[model samples]
Target: MSDWGVDRGVRVLKGVRHFRHRIRRKMDIMFDAYLNSEGDFPMCDSPVWIFGRSYSVNYDLDELRRSVASCMWVTYRKNFGSVGETSLTSDKGWGCMIRTGQMFMAKALILRHLGIDWHWEPDSRDPSYLKIVSLFADLNSAPFSLHQIAQTGSTLGKPVGTWLGPNTVCQAFKKLLSSGATGLDLTMHIAMDSTLVQSEVKRLCLSHPSINPFASATIPSSSIINTPRIDPKWRPLLLIVPLRLGLSDLNEAYVPGIKAVFEIPQSIGIIGGRPNHALYFIGYAENEVLYLDPHTVQPTVHVGSKLDESEKAADETYHSQKPGRMSFLAMDPSIALCFYCKSEADFDSLCRKLTDRFSVIPLPLFEICERRPQDWTTSDPIFMSSPRSNSSGGRNSPGGFTSIGLPGSSSSNSKTRMGSSSSSTFSGDVDDEEFEILG
Candidate 1:
């Protein structure tokens, strides 16, 4: 008999049916509990309707990392690791570990929820193996490392590997909901940003309908739809830009929108110093949740929570005395991260001259290397092999491999294509989307 026939034939007897029914009922109860619990989370005073989109992997950790990173490596580097930290040679290793692991698990969880097939794996990269090496090192150096636990299945002995962080594991929970189900979307918005200095945020729906990165991939290896996601229909982000005519600090501009004084962290500083008042920002939509900025905002919170009841706590800290940070913007400082600046003086000057003093600078954006004709022939080199660069040229991105020039090459090839090939990359924020900045 076939495997299914043998396994289920007698298994479907009276007792089996009763057990299955019990299991089904238990599952229903569990699902209802989760749905009901979602209500306990906070919501905006005036909620709005918005949609979301995403495109993620559905296979081995390495596979997803390789696939996603292969296209926009600069993004991986920017996101996964520290940036412009000249004090330290920023290695992309940690970033790779965190980002790839997160993507892999997120994809897997989504697929599992969708009842699709997807795989996950441990880190096989060399540096990743260093933790294992540490286990061996500890064995040679410390008594605890040498200690062994006796188990029924033990043959002789076991050298459990020193494991690296489960950036991957953490992502799995974030994607699946410790409770149940896994669904994601790059998230679109018809939202508001009233916290001050914040622009109205919206989703950039560039992924193809089939390339919902938030949604898990149904296939493993490359498929016909393997290219970066794109769509013809444009849904311009509802550009509710405040300061319709002025300039402000990028940090204060896009603070992730956070509500409720209760969810605020208990401490905002350390013993003898200020506790961190800033938090990784997330948002709510029609009762759904959205992950906004995670880091970069702590560039120094320097904000006063008007609703904070901890006046004694505030007086106890030296750091809280700093200038007030614009709080109304979405909480993420990175959201305000733009190279553009038009200082108060510049704006005042412009106002005096009856002109707009917006010294525009491009915000950080994902880069994609569009395969275009290489005009320069020189295999030149720039400062020890052209400074490391993002291949997907964004308006503000540095030159990539092209930055390197033969000993005798023109300056033309050195110019990086920082912008996308298409003017319509963003269906929503198009007309005013020229990567502008003002001080």
Candidate 2:
């Protein structure tokens, strides 16, 4: 907290109060109506993504089919085994259920293009979509272990063979991450990792810190894996895609030669076990849909103040990593995003960079309604023809099972984690009388 006091002229005057102006007018109107320009509504078959001129949109196209950035382009297919292309889970295919089926059909077409209707109970084989159920934390804290059950609510107990509320394995993993296709009993894996800082194990944790104490021996350098447990026999499948990055790129240089850029719209590790440090706006990954394969490598490390003309071996593999510029979120619990460091006396105010329209980051449906979630999924829809729409209605009387699904392979078993659904009636988290439903 001391360095942010002067270095670089009041650091842009205390970075204009955590980037005000209603957070840069909500990331300049959602980055200029879905990746800059074109937001009066009406563009169905939703899915747009063009780079070279910059792009980033997802299903909402209709009425005259406006330009949707020209149309289609998300990538990650490596699977076309039919049934929407493979999934026995040796860590999935067709690029993890068509990129989480265009990220839960673009979060239910941005909650029905912001109009928000359908009074719950949808899934009579996809009525357009709506599964909202959340629990988190178990299997010994498996990837966000339900964010420690929302930071420890109810003090957390039920550890053995868990499964309490409406569970059909979390309603068959929110009905298979909302894309369609299910089959799993137990057998899942995938790998491809990254998160450097070795150089002979940081000179042996700075020459033995009380003989390698812990934080995995001196706060992790970063890592993640399982792109098909490939051949350790198996034991790797972990998904937590919530995304957040920007702790000066993964620590190791606070000032001199400054440099940072960990993008990873999902691909910084392709899927192994040490390369997932790219984060951008808040991140999460314990389950809600995670199918895999998103790499775009090509940076030895240059970043900021002119690192060979702002680096981009091709837009840093779909650039991503933004959580208010990091403070703690990566020790590679099968990583969703990293370089936050938690706190150790605020490593130079958590490695600076929280702005240039990082504008305090937030929004993404208010960061998944402050993650008090019982439902989730979003991101990666540069374009492929607005391919994410499903909203049915029927079980208003059942009230069961929640979310988890992602069985492409690993020996294939048929997804698990337990479920029963029906919880987020929208009463807890962030309070003020709840009722968010967003637009």
The positional error of residue 354 in candidate 1, measured at the CA in angstroms, is 29
Runs in model 2 deviating more than 4 A are 1-20, 27-31, 34-181, 184-229, 241-439
C-alpha local distance difference test of each model: 0.22, 0.21
Stretches > 4 Å off in candidate 1: 1-40, 43-45, 48-282, 285-330, 336-385, 389-439
TM-score of candidate 2 relative to the true fold = 0.21
Per-residue lDDT of candidate 2, residues 1-439 (tens digit): 5675557667786688667964775455344323311212222232221111112223322311222211111223222222212222121221222222223222222222221222221111122221111011011122212222212211121121222111111222333322212111111111001112122222322242222122242322221110221222221111222221121121222111111112222111111111222111122111011112222222222222222434322223222221111111112111222221111222122223322212333311001111222322111111112212212311111111122211342231111201113232211111111011110
Best by lDDT: 1
Please write out the lDDT profile of model 1 over residues 328-437, one tens digit for every residue: 32121112110101122321232222111122223211111112234423221111222223233321111111232323543332221223333222210211211122
Q: What number of backbone clashes does candidate 1 have, counting pairs of residues 3 or more apart or in separate chains?
A: 40
TM-score computed on alpha carbons, candidate 1: 0.20
Q: How many clashes (backbone N, Cα, C below 3 Å) per candidate?
A: 40, 115
What TM-scores do the predictions have? 0.20, 0.21
